[model samples]
Target: MAKYKIKINPKNLPVFDKYWHYQKSVQSPDIDVKFFRKAYKEIFDKHAVLLREDFCGTFKLCCEWVKLRERHEAIGLDLDPEPLAYGKENYYPKLNSKEKDRLVTSEQNVLTAKLKKPSDVTVAVNFSYFIFKERQVLKEYFQNVYDNLGDQGLFLLDIFGGSDIFDLPEEETEFEDENFSYYWDQEDYNPILNHGLFHIHFKRKGEKKRKNVFNYDWRVWSIAEVRDILTEVGFAETRCYWEGTDKDGEGDGEFKPSEKGEAHCESFVAYVAGIKK
Candidate 1:
């Protein structure tokens, strides 16, 4: 009797395209559209006529912001040219003539980027500002936003936390019809240094998962710390909004005002708003 060997064959495996997988695995412009509209109206009691999106990758929000109203105009700023190009090719072409004229983007640093005047609202989402670890540096960024705001303007940022972030890996919510899965890889955590390293990975159902598609070096800043810095940087009022959980004890994607927070398991998302004086 001959011994049989089991072989892993590449020809039989599903081919996962990097860019295609990323495009299909992530993105929900409608959610940002809803959040931006609600957030803008919350601050101004009316739809914001102008918006500035800092550190905008692909600028899905900016495109949606412009489509919300005829008078609405949006400026998206990002350092990388790749996502900018992707937005131009994929998202921009999908816009109408009027919306196209209303939406404009530039490749630049968030610190130096400025709008015509202080916009009605300026947003920094995706926790991109975590790159600034130092308090003073973060304050400087917020102060710039304070200086660039129109009267009664608001600066919005989203933050994530939970005890589980100390040193652990987590999976992202899976979307139907998408053939990939996302992973948040937390490699190390330093309580003293407040340093954390994270990576984004993707897995296709029938293929081996791809690792480290994107990596980040960020400091997990607390809400208190962020609020303190925002106030010190010249914001008149800083408010934190806690996310609401459904009966299943999962986030419902709706965030409401809450100054006080309760301790939860390994994860949470919150919004921090700073009112420009």
Candidate 2:
């Protein structure tokens, strides 16, 4: 009897799209819209007409903003071409002509980008500004945002912190419907500098794990410290929006302005908004 060899066919293997996976797992554009708009109305007692999204990977937030109202406009700024191209090809095409005209994006740095008009709101979420580990650089970036905002404008950013962030080595989240697993690997941390190395990896079902889908070298900034820097950089006032907890102690998806945060959680995410005088 002849022995037959078992073959592994490449065509039958699983495929992974990191950006697609990231949007599903991490971003909630609809929620961001509600928060941004509501926060604006609460702070300034008026509607925000234009928004600028700094370090806006894929510009999904900008796309969503234009959809909110006919007069609403959005601008997205980023230095990378790959994600910008990805947004142009994927998300931009989904918008109608009116929204397409209302939304604009540029391949430029947040620190020096020039816009035709100042934005009513500028957002840098997902801890993207943590890239500026130095206090001076971060303050400089904040000052630029301050100078570029319209009167009564606001700058919003999201940050995560807790005792566990420094201690947790790694975390894995599985999406059964998407047929993949996401991993956040905290490879290194320096207590002295408050800096950390993080990597995002993905594993498709029945496939080998992919490493370093995204990587970040960031200094973990405290909420208090960030507020101080915003004030020092010329923001008239700084506010924190703390997320409420459900019965199970998980974030209940509602954020209200608060000066004091709740006690003792493994990790928490909150928004800090800087109001221009």
Candidate 3:
């Protein structure tokens, strides 16, 4: 693994933020906020005014949520202070006075953090919850979420699985406009435990690849397993929102309620929503 380096030369005049690049390449906070707001209304027959973003890196979703409605408020929780500080410095400055006041972030663990008030919606997206590899611990975390949600609150999670992720040990994606390439490196996997060790690497043009910018040791849970856990944790019902396929048979970015999923064609992403009674 190469160490991170900055080209300290007059020739390289532009400054860059790797986190910004990561968000642009992989995250769609705008779309996420839209879906959450709309889904809440459709599911509960009422608008959701409060959202709690678990494992919210950079709290981008929190920033977006406050922007959706003046009455909306958001809280973001993460154990790391680095990204939280980054959000305070970069993303927070972009918010107006009202939005800034509505968005709050805390450096705390998801399992034990105390919210000022119960949340109307709790979201753990991007497979961040996979860090809890143990079934008991994952259920405990879900239970904590359930305990903190208001009546009829929803819990949302995004998950991915398919033949492609299992077959490939490593995959690379290039973003020409961003001038960087991202790599997903699977170092090892245990079939017996369904555990995997993975790392994220990045390389800018004309520079050495920076390895292990982010690493995850995750236990990939199936949809059925997750739904069962949510149910056990006191969610009255659960539903899956499967992504639609485009002409090329790739995910088209539109997700809708599904009882059955599309055929497993190498890879897929889906959202699971747990509704509180």
Candidate 4:
């Protein structure tokens, strides 16, 4: 066997280490909670309350969202049931009755899911909407979101791309603390349509490297394409919140609205907000 420049943690830990160790540790729910509050209060002056998380795998954010207020309610919709069960076992158990009562998880497709009442804030983070590879399909999903919004509501989602994102074969990231190196393998990319295949692998020090821990076949949609779709969906206005990097040139986990961004290393993340009419 040969070794690459990276190693991934195998997630063999008996107690469901994949979500907590890999996803939750790196994910910043504090940032999410903050943005949801700011974006809501900024628009409706503390009137927004109900939140819907589309493609809410595991609904981790939903668990955190309800904690923001006793009155706050969250609805998480996703096609997959595994993560939802895991959230029930791990995150849901940790919350009190009132908090747990405020959260709702539905195992349904996001495109077809219906909200009893219009949501004040709805989000599709981690670029989950990338599953829709075609422009029309993506626009329909955005339109669904727009229709599901309350008066003065907001639709938010994250997008990331750079010169490096396209035309790249593979890239590796090393995390020494966890004794693993994460790989963002860009197996293929199409310049004509900006579609691609991506995989995540992990290598543990002195252990056999794990390949394809997770795989994603995404469209690699651009900011312009997404912005255009939001407008087509009849959103009154749209905004992009670019991320700031720290002194070490790593994502500082902070996002602020901006019109322009500078180029960066292998990968990056940011949010696109659509204001409902």
Report lDDT (CA) for all predictions: 0.79, 0.89, 0.88, 0.80
Model 3 spans > 4 angstroms off: 1-16
Candidate order by decreasing lDDT: 2, 3, 4, 1
Clash pairs, candidate 3, are none
Poorest 10 consecutive residues of model 3 by lDDT? Answer: 1-10
Report residue 130 deviation for candidate 4 (angstroms): 0.7
Worst 10 residues of 4 by lDDT: 1-10
Q: Could you say which candidate leads in TM-score?
A: 2
Q: How far is candidate 4 from the true structure (C-alpha RMSD, Å)?
A: 5.9
The sequence of per-residue lDDT tens digits that candidate 3 reaches over residues 1-277 is 1123323457766555667767876789989999998888999899999999999988999999999898999999999887887788778889999999999998889988888799999999889999999999999999999999999899999998877666646788999987899888888777788887888888889989988888899998888899999999999999999999889877888889998886655778899999997
Q: Candidate 2 lDDT, tens digit per residue, 1-277?
A: 1222223469864345567878987889878987999999898999999999999988999999999988899999999887887788779889999999999998898888888899999999889999999999999899889988998999999999887877856889999997889898989889999999999998888889999999999999999999999999888999999999899889999999898886676789999999996
| TM-score of candidate 2 relative to the true fold | 0.94
| lDDT computed for candidate 3 | 0.88
Query: What are the TM-scores, per candidate, against the unseen true structure?
Result: 0.88, 0.94, 0.93, 0.87
Candidate closest to the true structure, highest lDDT:
2
Q: Give candidate 4 misplaced runs (Cα > 4 Å).
A: 1-17, 24-26, 167-169, 247-250, 263-266
- For every candidate in turn, the CA RMSD to the true structure comes to 7.8, 6.8, 3.3, 5.9
Order of the predicted models by TM-score, top scorer first: 2, 3, 1, 4
